[model samples]
Target chain A: MATLELQGIRKSFGTTHVLHGIDLAVAEGEMIVIVGASGCGKSTLLRIVAGLETATEGRVIIAGADVTRLEPKDRDIAMVFQNYALYPHMSVFDNMAYGLKIRGLPKAEIRARVQQTADLLGIGQLLERKPRQLSGGQRQRVAMGRAIVREPKLFLFDEPLSNLDAKLRVQMRAEIKRLQRRLGVTSLFVTHDQVEAMTLGDRLVVMHEGRAEQVATPMEIWRAPANTYVAGFIGAPAMNFLAAELVEGGAAAKLKAGATIAFADGVHPGGEGAPLIVGIRPEHIQAGSGPGSLPLKVDLVEPLGAESLIHGALPSGETLTVRMSDCSPLAGSVLPVVLPPASLHVFDAEGRRIEAVRRRERTAAAGAVGA
Target chain B: MMHGPIDATRLAAAERAAMKAEAARRRTDIVTHAILILGVVLFALPIWIVLMGSTHDVGTIARGEVPLLPGPYAVQNYLTALGEGSARTTRVPVALMMVNSFIMALLITVGKIAISLTSAYAVVFFSFPGRMVAFWSIFITLMLPVEVRIFPTFKVVSDLGMINTYGGLIIPLIASATATLLFRQFFLTIPDELVEAAKIDGAGPLRFFKDVVLPLSVTNIAALFVILFVYGWNQYLWPLLVTTSGDVETIVIGIVRMIGSEADTDWNLVMATAVLALLPPVAVVILMQRWFVKGLVETEK
Candidate 1:
């Protein structure tokens, strides 16, 4: 296992900058997943670390060795490609043994290692079969087995599960997590899937455009997203955003829909009449009429067996989605839904998060209690 | 629905339709067999004529009445052709020429495959300066057949003192852009991930070529071997230009030498040699037919 650090890594392909100075430090044996939309430089960053692509600027230091100029094999890293990339002409045994054979291992040791890995991957019976004879999930297992048998210092996966069907993807995803935990090898996995990132990474690096937007634990990112982008991108059915003006001396926000909603715990960090954006997750919205409840006109309902998604419009003519129990509300009915202040996230005009105005309220409450 | 009285006319019409369909199918089967038999006859007629001519004495064929049946001198004609050749031509044994032809064809086939495989591998896998220019230069050679550049090529061969040697016969003909292009096309279908995986597996370019690429190319190589072998064995012009002595005479050119300009040609021996020349290539095609067809079609994709 090794600690990997990327210091100011940047890349450009003829002035088309793909990665814009990404800096990250991964602890030993931690899985750092880089998740983003396509063309967001996630794969480019992984390739740079694998020594398949060169970085225009910065150092790739693994285990305290600056390997910016080293080859992939010299860096002691193994990669599982998106397509599995097994040697089609070779049997599973030879495919797993190829790396060791190239490293000039003895024949008996190579066979033993391959057998052991095949057993670990549950592909022991498939050792003599070629890649074309195996199903997709089996091929994926062999690909992983090929990487695991090498026992390299670091493992890099480039969307290895993307090619599998949805059900197999989940199975293989869990298998990869279990295997990585058992091996405890420092790994860097790049994918365009948010759920894969959330379930697999020790810390998720949510990237946008060409930069790392946030690097935090999945729960932390889900609970306290750093910006509007993370808040919208991380959750299913997405978080709802509303334009509002801070009123009552930064204590509450007057929504454009004419509902004045107060902070449940503290005041927001904005002056009166200051413009802001409020974010509320779909699952967090409570259904009932209350003091801070916003009126929703239900337009459509999607029943998903356990929970239904209610897509509707607010009084301000902005669309909102709510994850509620699997009971359909009548179309065109107005339902009052409460966006709890504790679950509210406030952002500035530039989409950056501004701290909830807690100091003023906390100080006043503490002073009153003391008196 | 209430069943109406059974209509005899409708039953008759249905039976007539089924009978007509059966007749049509039988007609098609007959037509197909007729065409196939005609094709088989068209191919086999020449071999039949050669066989009959080889068995007959020289006078019967030279008299311009082609024999339709084999004669009694089949053993004598074949023995003469194999052991002593014809007395009217250069006295080199036809057996020796057959050996020389076999050697040349084998060399050319093996040599072209080796050169093309490596060159195509380099062109497909590596990036260096003028890579496209080098590939285009090789591709352009396809337009210039050896017949177009024969003199200059022969001059170069003579300058290198390769005349009358196997190197002269084989080397100039071995630089085939078609084979190289075919192999290059095959190599391009190999996934780029395989290369990356090989690199991470600690296999360098040469090792990867040996362990992975070559194994995948077996069918293509076998197919090309069949084509190049036939091409090399049938070569008449270049071999005639290079080898002056009877020692290096190939069977194809040696067959022509059997017919003297001013003397009665050894028709029996010549026909026997023609039979010999046709055997090896036909055997090769029949043996490697499966791989040959597969390689041709798969490489197109």
Candidate 2:
């Protein structure tokens, strides 16, 4: 059974619609991440689930019960905020035990729970110190301990690691994943960082303009983005897009830059000469001449130790970036690069994925490789 | 070339430049100190004269020559001011007036802070019908000070039969907007995440106020306490209009009454009452000076 469900959630603040209708479900103990840029309503959706916000039109069901109208305290959820939000005046121990005390748990039980969680987070010695005195990472641990001690039915995180330095963020990211897995609690984490979303979520909900652009595992999202926004947003050194038209009965696409690349199989879903978008990740292109290769005029080279990025323009003045192993290529030289048919992602003119040809071929190839 | 004859002209020119810079710095330092000292003396003169006058006999003060030195009668003047009431005024002891002032100030400061803190919390943290309307109504009170609309407020207090009571003196003046505005501004600076975090921790609105909001507001409360206490203690007009009886009279009103009409006025006793009145506010400011400065600067920010 799904542990949490949001059905047709819609929100508007004074006629300014912040969230369009959103629907989602989380299986028991699954970690779902809602990732989006700022103002995309990801945080608003999380707040609605936490019972901090009331959806304009929808039902929020937790543990098979409708809790859309309940207060946040009665929702049986724990949240860790980006700023940690540990009570400034309370000791670390008191901060962790605050929720339990409010729930009318006995003193002994609250103490034991807080101590156990504090020890787990390795903040046992800092229990007597106030939040103002601890380092940022320590405060973050205390915040997580506060949530963990509650033992609530659901966990919500709103960019909890965004405040920390990069190194600490990575460390805390692993700690949170490990803790969540061990606790086996259903969780929803919201973040704008694509790498964090990719590494942390069991399934990522990529949101754009108050809509969920796509929901899939990280590898699936990387391999096949649902739209132009998701394709540009999910990768570091994002995917490159080029205008193209399907030709030769959809067996191949002729780029506007005048390069024709063949599909893996002669399968065409659209009519001949249909306008399309060709999406290719930087890492997918290789530096070599082949049957369907295009010559690229190298403009700049970025050497990053083990690998180098070759930034260049095609013959028709369209820019392209190719990630390759470290090798010094002279500037202003024409390098022939190949685009394998299986590596190309084709989208319609409206930026929606057209999976008729490539998806089937990729899955079949995967099945063959697995067999 | 053995340093080219020691270059006496360049060395002399460098020394002359250094001497000129030194003289200019000395002149600026002298002028700065002179201006600061003048400002200090100008502000301190009235207080110094009052202090010296309070130590003298009534006859010496009545001569119209400002007393420049402490007299031999400092102890007797304060004793008579605190114990025996001034003869020309209604014979309620200054001690009783001091107590009344203290009580009124304490009540007003505490009442205003309590009211402002809760109202500001509601305005900033919760959303309800008329939230902004209520906030704007409170904010509008800043323009309508106690001096304005004084008659209506007094009439209301009289209708409630609270005339000559401490409530009449404090309650009508308790609903101030500056403190509420200060608190509201400070509360808005509290990150919304703290409230959300508290909610997720199973805290209700009241719990969040007490545990999170109140602690964060300590400096602000202390700071406002100093300012509001002085404001309450120094209230003269309202107390005079409301308290017809000497028993409920504040020290500020009592001091004004100490001066008799014409030549019979006891200036020494009036100055003594002034000194006593100055003590509580001065002590409050001194005690909470650190938090006061921090609160003032931070709340403004």
Weakest lDDT window of 10 consecutive positions for candidate 2 chain A: A354-363
Each model's C-alpha lDDT?
A: 0.90, 0.89
Instruction: Please write out the lDDT profile of model 2 over residues B1-301, one tens digit for every residue.
Output: 7656577777888999999999999999999999999999999999999899999998997877789899999999999999987886667789999999999999999999998998898888888999999999999989876678999988899999999998888888878688889999988988888888888777888888888788779888997898899998998889999999888988998888888775888888999888998999998889889776775554331
- Which portions of model 2 show Cα errors greater than 4 Å? A326-328, A356-371, B1-28, B63-66, B290-301
Off by over 4 Å in 1: A360-371, B1-6, B261-263, B290-301
lDDT of 2 by residue, A50-151 (tens): 988899999999999999999998989999988888777788999999999999999999989898999999999999987878899999999899988988
Backbone clash total for model 1 is: 2
For each candidate, give its TM-score against the true structure.
0.94, 0.91
Best by TM-score: 1
| Model 1 agreement with the true structure over A24-96: per-residue lDDT tens digits | 9999999999998899999999999999999999999999999999999899999999999999878899999
The residue pairs found clashing in candidate 1 are A267-A357, A268-A357
Model 2, residue A348: C-alpha shift (Å)? 3.3
Per-residue accuracy of model 1 over B1-301 as CA lDDT, tens digit each = 2334356667888999999999999999999999999999999999999989999998888888788898999999989999998876567788999999999998999999999999999899999999999899999999987899999999999999999988888899888899999999999999999999999998999999999898889888988988999998999999999998788889988988887763478899999999988988888888888776775554331
